[model samples]
Target: MPDASPTLGEAGAASVSPTAVLTIYIPSEAPQDKVTRAIDAILAAHPWEVPVIEVSETRLVMCG
Candidate 1:
């Protein structure tokens, strides 16, 4: 007997992938303490134990 599994071209054959993006905004007038806490919270919630962190004058990016 032949196997029953359908080929990639069949209906429901292709799998769907998921993605997530996080963006943080810091105002020019925001306090340093508040900014620190916000960044800390973001790092704490990230999945990676040691995420690669990068920053510029305006933004921060964290990648695992």
Candidate 2:
């Protein structure tokens, strides 16, 4: 499975930026319903207006 943690990188600023690109990986063994629910939960928790959700067979990328 791919790491679900946020990938930390510098954004060429003097201070460390909080802006992050989160990528969630859902395994093949995981059910589609569960994955959907998880994604929903994450979105609800964050509640970002312009969040980007890119879904593929193996991964989901949520960027704000």
Candidate 3:
């Protein structure tokens, strides 16, 4: 069957504000470990504490 889910590129088009809960959908095949490691490295190298990163595979629906 054809994929029915929206792609990361499409989902990212939505506005993301600090006051709002923004959900980012990344590819399942992506190397999450590497991404987290990179993020950790950046945080360690910098002085700012990065926001909490919650990872999960769940379906999301948006109604207008």
Candidate 4:
């Protein structure tokens, strides 16, 4: 018989605290309003603390 257990990434994983920091990455092509609405909906469901959002287009580039 196999050991029936849920992995860390499974649904049994611990839930995140509302005050925990959230990091979201929006694709360049995604609509800002739509993304904002989706984020708002998530926040509304969990009621998290005000997040530190950083929006940048060039942050992922290498300057070497």
lDDT of 4 by residue, 1-64 (tens): 1332422223435544335556677788898899889777876765324344566664576788
The superposed Cα distance between candidate 2 and the true structure at residue 56, in angstroms, equals: 1.5
Off by over 4 Å in 2: 1-18, 58-64
Q: Tens digits of per-residue lDDT for model 3 on 1-64? A: 1332332223325433434344566666779797788657655764323355577887668999
Query: What would the per-residue lDDT of candidate 2 be over residues 4-57, giving only the tens digit for each residue?
Result: 233343333333436568887778889979988998887786644435778877
The total number of steric clashes, by the backbone 3 Å criterion, in model 3 comes to: 0
For each candidate in turn, the TM-score is 0.49, 0.50, 0.33, 0.40
Global lDDT for candidate 4?
Answer: 0.59
lDDT of each: 0.61, 0.64, 0.54, 0.59
RMSD of 3: 17.3
Winner on TM-score between 2 and 4 is 2
Instruction: Choose the strongest candidate by lDDT.
Output: 2
Please report how far candidate 3 places residue 26 from its true position, in Å: 0.7
- Supply the global lDDT for candidate 3: 0.54
Q: How many clashes show up in model 2?
A: 0
Query: Over the full model, what C-alpha lDDT does candidate 2 score relative to the true structure?
Result: 0.64
> Where's the lowest-lDDT run of ten residues in candidate 3?
1-10
RMSD of 2: 13.4
Model 3: how far residue 10 lies from native, Å = 39
Q: Give the residue spans of candidate 1 off by over 4 A.
A: 1-19, 59-64
